[model samples]
Target: MTTNPYDDIAEWYDDRVRSAWGHPGDESDLLAMLTGLTGDVDGLDICDLGCGQGIVSRRFARMGARVVGVDISSRLLAIAAREESANPLGVEYVNDDAQSLSRLSGGSFDGVVCTWSMADIEDLDSCYRSVERILRPGGWFVFLITHPCFQGPGSRWVGAERVVVDYFAEGFWRSENPDGVRGKVGAHHRTLSTYLNGLVEAGLSLERLVEPCGIAPINASLPDTSKVPVFLAVRSRKT
Candidate 1:
């Protein structure tokens, strides 16, 4: 797949990823964090960047926020639309690259969220800047992504240390699926510092950082899963 498989994988995308994320402990941790982060969304204006299949997007709408979900893939947007209609949580959908949240009105949102999508973006600086532009001063920008400190392209999951090969830099990562070869998946990698600096450059202040050990059955056996963080959730405020 040269291009993003989201367009073609829309049908089965939800099932596959959902199964992986829906692990009992995984879901609980995410839900608990989200519930705590967003206690009462009675009238907040929220935007979900790269809101795949409207998972978190719809959830926010259900919390009584006026939600807008944006994505680059039409296929994912289609599925998100279907989900919006079926659930009818009043979530609005937009098809656009997350790097350009400027398409929306300035200072239009109280909270902006990006989940599991930052890794796929080529320009983290632009994306953070755009998010800052769309959010009101003091508004929150919550981002969830794969932990870059441990996971990177071609980094084998061999028990503990995710031995990364020649990918010690912060940029694009390429991996081969057929084997542990490089340059196959066109994977990208960025150091955690790059992301933090990007947010600071965008005029956002870091509030909290969380590395969630997903609530999957395998978590019980994998020592690395508990010792090392797998996913990161960053909370920031547009200042």
Candidate 2:
């Protein structure tokens, strides 16, 4: 049977994942970066690719953009739907695979936003291709993912030094943290080259790459601003 990490914590994933950082739109860094690349978001048709629970979608919708949120997790979609109903911001939530966002019309979206989901994708090439197909020329695709260098489930803390196994390796990975609640259920690890090459192969041009650090909620409590680079934010455009 295929494992679903979100399913295990479906009931609490929202609070845990959402609160893992401070505030709801802590992911606004990606949005800010994207808007910096494209400028102005009003009336834009935005697709929240792999949008879990519609947090980012809600933010975009509030900005007067037409937001369509797509994800594979039914549980997460349920949460997203609830938010949409309450907010009535015209955000549409669809249960769909990231690699094939066929349910959405082609060349329709002005921007595609994804958060913390790229590493979990098994077929990234297909995902990028689908993004290219769905976005109009010059449309932007922004994404946040785990930093391939320092973060993952296989990381071990031996004394004060941390050890990472297969940090450079790519392909499916499965590792369980001691807490069990946090785990790498299954994922594809790729280098910067892989993602850049995939974008080029999909006829997209890389515009910006960000390695965000010390942005987590816990970081605010820490005196020192060093643990790891926990996130990678990327912006690409269909050409």
Candidate 3:
């Protein structure tokens, strides 16, 4: 069986990769951004696409939303299930690809959230289509991804803490993981226009854009992020 990259690193991700997804005040945190976008989500039916280890899904449940966490990796779902069992947050976990949520019916969710996984998804356009199909009209699709303009495998630090990045370079790129979530992980990069266009093509209206930094938590080691954004979070409506 081909091993899923996320599955290989699920155990260490909470402590290692979690911060990369952002937190309450860290800016690019999709959960925090979603809360700000849709106030009072109590009783909302939410689907967490690409929900690795169910961290955000549990958070959504805590916010009084009925949450279902979905991912392509069984290993990650297993870890999420373990966490859910321990806490009993009433979050459902599913093992499935984000691009093909065939088990779910159309117009089923009130909102959807995906964080720190867009760059890694091979068929993001398909995922967007699925998200649009599953979300009711006016439902929100919130997501966060590494800022393609300033953060990627093509980025390098230079003198005076300057950043050299390839804004136009696009494709799969691999880099060594400093957090040991894995020795290496592959992330696909596309232009900012490409990301925005994908949503437009999928019938989602861009509502808000935020470039958040993880400076407070990671600036000591990744100082470049303090100067530039680490991630881009978007809130789109399926209207």
Candidate 4:
């Protein structure tokens, strides 16, 4: 059976997302970098691709950007929508696949932000293509993903050293979430080259790349994670 990570663990995911004092608006550094690349967000339309529970979506709206959140999981979207109802942030939540983005208008978005969800997606090429189609010319597509070279389910800690066995293989494996509530969740793994080449094929020009030191909540617990790049953030512009 195919695995659904956030379906049942939506509550857990929501709590963790809210409690993450470390990551304000996913990551302060990421927001700064995205803004630097895309310019001011005020009065701009943005898509939160693969947005789970609309955590970052609301943040962007608070920053004066019109935010539209798209995700495949009904459970996650429900949570996001519920929160939107309570806060009236004007953030719209759509139940849609990131790989297609058919429901979103083409060339309508000023920027796309996919935070910590790139590895969670399987068909990244299609997602990039759809994002490119939805973005206006010169619009930026910014993403944060677990470093394909350093982080994965197969990682092992041997005396302070985090070692990974296979760097070339791309596949899905059960998630190792600390709460253990989402054991059936699968994390899709891909190489750095695959993502880079896929963006190039999608006709997006690579503008900025960031490897934040264990800044995200998921990697903050790992020993010495902050010392090395555990999460990689990339910004590409549609030409």
Candidate 5:
């Protein structure tokens, strides 16, 4: 079996995520955008793809959805399962890669959500295909990712302005700054078009797009991020 890159840093990453959630003033808009896109998931069967530590999955379960959180990292899933056991939200955590989702049944979900995890996935096309396969007819797929244009390889914040280099450079890249998540796990960089086109190819139609402006709590190193959009959220429907 292939070793999960997140297994070693699972505990550290969970702590960082929890700390970020505690700071109300530094909250990220991705979750808000997700809520707006997926209004009232009450009693809906929702899948939280690439769910780490059950953060977003718990929210969905609390909203009355039968949530199944899938992730590749066993360590992260352990944390998620432990939290579920303590809180009893009825969330089921499954250890599976987003690219395949071999454990999940096809057309079994009312909606699928991937928040801030698309970049971490290596095979964008395969992941999108899995998302499409898992959703019921007309089921929505909502996702939020770092703005690829401004957050790609060699991109950084200089003073109050954002500097972007190699925007067209696609593939795996890691940030030099060790404090950031990208610096730790690295990410697959793809153009905005690549994401949209890939979705279309996977039989998911783009329904809505949101470029939210706010400084993500995790992006402390990128100052003045509010001046520009830091995250891109999209709502797509299976066709």
Candidate 6:
């Protein structure tokens, strides 16, 4: 079996996500934006694509959605399963690749959400296709990703502003900053057009898009990001 890149850092990543819950910024903003775009998911069958440790999955379950959390990392899924066993929210965690959720039945989901995990997926096109396949007609697909234009490789904060060294360099790349998440797991960078085009090609219709602004705990070396939009959230429907 191929080694999952997130397996080794599962604990570290879980801790980071847990810590973010206490901070009233990026994490909170992300969840708010997600739920807002999804509207009410009561009794809806929802899939949490690339669900790391049941963070968003639990939230969906709490909101009355039957949730399935899928990811490639067994270590992360273990933690998520452990949490489910402990709390028993009826969330099912599946160890599977986001690009090809072979175990999930087609047209089985009323909604699908991918949060902060799109960059981790290697093939955006395949992932979007999988999402469209799993979603029932008129089902919604919502996602949050670091702004492709401002958060790609070689981009960083200079004083109060963000600097992008290159926007057209699209591919897999690792951040030089050892302390950041990208430096550890790396990320596949895609242009905004590539992302939108992939969704359109997958038979998904764009509905709403938002560039959200929030303050999150950052490395001391970085400046305030509240004034700048760091993440982009999109809501689409399967046509």
Q: Which candidate is the best by lDDT?
A: 5
- Estimated TM-score for each candidate: 0.85, 0.85, 0.87, 0.88, 0.94, 0.94
Native RMSD of candidate 4 (Å): 3.0
lDDT of 5 by residue, 127-147 (tens): 999999999999999998988
All models, RMSD in angstroms: 3.7, 3.1, 3.1, 3.0, 2.2, 2.4
Local error of candidate 4 at 74, Å? 1.1
Clashes of each: 5, 0, 0, 0, 0, 0
Model 5 vs. true fold: TM: 0.94
RMSD of candidate 2 to true structure, Å: 3.1
Q: Tally clashing residue pairs in candidate 4.
A: 0
lDDT: the better of candidates 4 and 5: 5
lDDT, candidate 3, 1-239, per-residue tens: 23478776776775554565564224443455557766677999999988888877877888899999988878888888988888898999877778888878899999998877787788889989999999999899988776777766546556536464666778887655564331356788788899999999999999998876553443446655656776678889998
In model 4, where is the ten-residue run with the lowest total lDDT? 175-184
Worst 10 residues of 1 by lDDT: 178-187
* lDDT score of residue 128 within candidate 6: 93
lDDT of 1 by residue, 69-175 (tens): 98887878888888667768889998877777656998999998887788878888889888999998889998877778777756666666666665567677665
Per-residue lDDT tens digits for candidate 6, residues 128-202, read: 999999999999999988889888889988878888987899999888888668999899998999999899999
Which regions of candidate 3 are displaced past 4 Å? Answer: 1-3, 17-31, 159-162, 176-183, 213-215, 218-220
Among all windows of 10 consecutive residues in model 2, the one with the lowest summed lDDT is: 216-225
TM-score computed on alpha carbons, candidate 4:
0.88
